[model samples]
Target chain A: MLTALARDLAAPLAANGSFLIKPGVGLMVWTLLVFGLTMVLLSKLAFPRISAALERRQKAIEESIDTAERTRAEAEQILAEYRQRLQEARAQADEIIQRARQTAEVQEREAKERGQEIVAEASQRAQREIEAATKRALEELRNEVADLTITATEKVTRKALDPEDQKRLVEEALREMDFSGLSSGASNN
Target chain B: MNATETGGLPPRPAPEEARIPAPHPTDDPAPKSSVKRKLLIALGVYLAGLIALIAIYGFKGHRNELFKPQNEFKLESWVDLGIFSINKAVLYLFIAAALTCVTMIYIARRMQQRPNKVQAAVEALFRLMHDNITASAMDERMAAKWFPFIGTLFLFILFSNLVGYIPLPTNTENEINVFGLQIPSFSLYAATANLSVPLVLALTVFVSYTVEGIRAKGPIGYLKGLIPGGVQGGMAVPIFFLEVLSNLMRILSLTIRLFANILAGHLIILFMAGALAVILGSAWLGWFTLPFGIILFAFEVGLVAALQAFIFATLTAIYLGGAVAKDH
Candidate 1:
C-alpha cells in the first residue's frame, strides 16, 4: 500500500505532473473545512476574550487614572480651604487679644478716674466737716461768751439782757457764717 | 535516457532505471548520526520543501539526491494527491491544528487582569497581531471588528508554518511485513508548503473581504463603488469593470505569493542539504558546505516561519481596509 502510494506520488512529479499543475480539489476543500472550523472556533473561543481582556484592562487603567486625578484635585482644594481657615483663625485670635488689651486699658482708665473723683469728694467732705467743727466751736464760744457776759452782767446788768435777743444774736451770727464760700475757698487752698 | 520523450506528450512511465546508473555505496548520503551530515541534510530538506521543483526527484534509497542534475523533487505521499489520496501533510495539519487549539484554550481560560509572565507574553503577542496587522491597516473601529478574524488567521498560519519545521521520520523505504502484506511508513510534510492550503486560505480572505464590501455598501452600491470617482460617461463602465478585475486579481496574487514564498524557502533549504550530500561523495569535502547550510536552515526555520504568516495577515488586513473604505 505504501509503495502504491509512493508510486502514485511519483506519477505526479513525473516529466509533466498532469495532475500537479492543477491544485487538488480535495485538499483545498479539506483546508477550507479545517480553516473554517479553526477560524470559527478561534474567533468564538479565543479572539473575543483576547480583545475584550485588552479593552477591559485599558478601561480599568483609564478609570484608575481618572480616580487618582479626581482625588488629587479634591485633596488640593481641601488643603487650600484648610490653609485659608487657619489664616482666618490666626487673625481672629489676634483680634481677640487686641480687644482684650483695649478693654483692660479702658477699665483701668475708668477705675483711675472714679478713684480720683472719690478722692476729690472725700477731701470736700473733710473740709465741710472741719468748717462745721469750727462753726460748732464758734457757736459754743459764743454761747460761753454770752453766758459769761450774761453772768457778768447779771452780776452788774445781766438782769437787763433778754434771753430771746441772745438766742437771736447767736442764730444770726451762725447764719452769717456761709460755709459754701468758705469750704470752696478751703477746697481751693 | 528517455530525455527525448518530452513533458508535452502525456506522461508514460518509462523505466528510468536503465539510463540512470545504479547508485554506488559512495553515491548515497552520509549517516545522520554525524553532526555535519545532519545539519547539511536538514538544510537541504528545508530547501527542498519550498518552490516548484522542476526535476528534483527525491533520494534513491538513501542516496545524495541533492545536486543530481536530472532529479525531480520527491513528492512523498503518506497518502497521494493526484489520486485524491490523503497525504502526511493532512495528518501534520491536524496535529498542528490540535496543538494550537489546546494551547490557545489553556492560555485563554487563565487570562487575567493582572497577568502572570506567560499571560503577559501571550497578551503581547496577541496585541502585536492587532497592532501589526489590523490597526496598522484600518481605522480603530474596523480594527476592533476585524481583529478576531485577522488575529486568528495570523496565529493559525504561524503555528501551521512553524510546526512544519519539526523533523519527521525520513521516508526511506521501510518494511514491516504483516501476514504477507508489506506495510510502508512515511514522514509528514508541512501543510503550508501545499498550494491547496494557501489557496483555501486565500479564498477565505477573498470571500470575507468581498462580503465586507457588500455589507458596507449594499450589493448594488458595492458594484457601483468599484468605479473610479472621477470617471464619467461610458469610460466609467469600462474602468469599473477593470477595477473589479483588479480587485479579483487580489485573490490569485495572495494565494500564489504565500505558496511560492513557502515553496521557494523549502526548495532552497533542501537544495543546500542535497548539495552537501553530493559533496560528501568526495571525502572531507562535504564539511566545507556545513556552516552555510546550517545557518540558512536555522534562519528560515526561525525567521521565515513568523514572517510569511505576518505578510499574509497584513495583506489580508489591507484588502479588508480597501473593501470597507468610505470613498470606495
Candidate 2:
C-alpha cells in the first residue's frame, strides 16, 4: 500500500517544480543563496548590540563602585565632624567652670578683709568711750569725798593729811584707768 | 588610670579607624544572559531574512526571463596564463575570490578599533573556523601557524559552494556572453557542486601533508614512518611499501568522498525540483514541488557545506598531527 502511494506521489512530484532542485545549476543556486545570504545577514545585524550591552554593563559596574567609595568617604567626614564638635563643647564647658571657680575665690578673700577692718574700728571706739566714762566717775567721786573730807578735816584738824597717803591714792586711780581700757577692748572684740 | 590602659584608650580614637567599604557583589551574570539574548535575536533576524527572500521569490512566482530554459554554446578563443587556460571557470573563480577578499578586508578593517555587529559576526565565523576546524584537531599553536592556508581553504570552498545558487548575470540557463565567450553563462553550480573543485582541494591537502611530512621527518624518515615496528627481515620492506601505497590511497578516497557528497546533494535537490516541470506541462507542478524541495535543499546544502569543510580540515589536522607525532 505504501509503495502504491509513493508511486502515485512520484508522478505528481515529477510534475511539480523540480527544476528548483536540479543537480548542476539548480542545486548550486540554492546552496549559494542559503549560505551566502545567511552569512551576510548574520554579519550585518546581530553582534554590535551584544558588544555594546556588555560594555555598558561593565561601565555601570565601575561607576557603582566609584559611588560606593564616595559614600564611604562622606560617612567618614560626618564621623570626623561629630568628633570635632564633641571636643569643642567639652573644652568650652571646662573654661566656664574654671572662670566661675576663680570669681568665687576672689570674693571670699575680699569678704574676709572687710570683716577684720570692721572689728578693728569697733575696738578703738570702745576704748575711747571707756576712758571718757572713767574720767567722769572719778570727778563725781572726788566732789562728794571732798565735802566729807572738809568736815572731817575741821573736826579732826589737829593732824593735816600726810604726803605718803596722798601719793598712794593717786597711784590707785591710775591703775583703775588701765584696767578699764583693757575691759573695753575685750568687749568690742 | 593604669598607664597601659590610658595609652590604649587614647589609641581608641585613632584616625585609621574609618570603616572599610564592603566589596561590591560581582555575582551578576548579566553578560552571560546578554550573550544568550543576543544569539536569540540573531537567530530571529536570520530567519526573518530567509522569510523575506522567500517572499520576494514567491511574489515573483519564482520565474524570471533568464531562468527560461534554453541551451546553446559558442566556442571562444582562450587566453593562456602560462600553466593553464584562463577559461570561464577560472574567471568565475577570480570574481568570487575577489568578492570574498573584499568582504573579508572590509570586516577586518572595521574591526581594528571595535567590532560592530557585522564585524563581530564575521570575526566569530573566523574564530569558529579556527577553533572547530583547525585547533580542535591539532595543537592550537600549530593551528595558528597554519591558519591562513587552512582558513582560506575552508572559506573559499564554502563560499564557492554557496555562490553556486546566486542567479548571476553569467548564470542563466540559456547562452550568454562572458569574457568574450558565447557560452552557457549562468549554470547554477557551486564550484564544490562540481567534482573537480573538491578533487582539486583534496589534491592540495595531499600535497601539503606530503611536503609537511618530509619537512618534519626528513625524506628517509617519512618513508620509514609507513612501516610498523617488529617486522622481521624482508617482510619489513613489503610492509613499508604497502603502507606507503595505503597512505596514497587515503588521499584519493578523501578527495572522492568530498566531491561525491557535494555532487550527490546538488543532484538530489536538482532532480527533486526538476520533477515538477518534467512531469507536468503546467507551472503548478513547480509550486507543488517547491516547499519540499526548498526544505530539503536547505538541510542538504547546510550539511554539505559544513561537512565538506569539516572533513577537509579534519584530514589535514590528522596528517599534520601524524607528521609531528613524537612516536612516529
The 0-to-1 C-alpha lDDT of every candidate, in the order given, reads 0.71, 0.59
- Model 1 scores a C-alpha lDDT of 0.71
lDDT per residue, candidate 2, B198-251, as tens digits?
A: 555566677777787788788888877757766768998888888888788877
Model 1: what is its DockQ? 0.19
State the DockQ of every prediction. Answer: 0.19, 0.01
Most accurate candidate by DockQ: 1
Give me the overall lDDT of model 2.
0.59
Q: Estimate, for each residue in A1-189, the C-alpha lDDT of model 1 and write its tens digit.
A: 558734643443464443333577777777777777777787788777777888999999999999999999999999999999999999999999999999999999999999999999999898788777776765677677667655665677536658886676556655665556654564555
Off by over 4 Å in 1: A1-22, A89-189, B1-75, B79-84, B135-146, B170-189, B218-220, B273-275, B279-286
Top-scoring candidate (TM-score): 1
The C-alpha TM-scores of every prediction are: 0.60, 0.47
Candidate 1, residues B1-328: lDDT per residue as tens digits?
2545665666566578866887896656644347687787867774554322312433322333333311222345565556455665566567667777777767887778999998898888888888978998899998988887788788778888777766565333444566996664333246777777888888889898999999999898888888867778989988988998988788788877777776656655654544434522422223334556567778877888888888889999998998888777
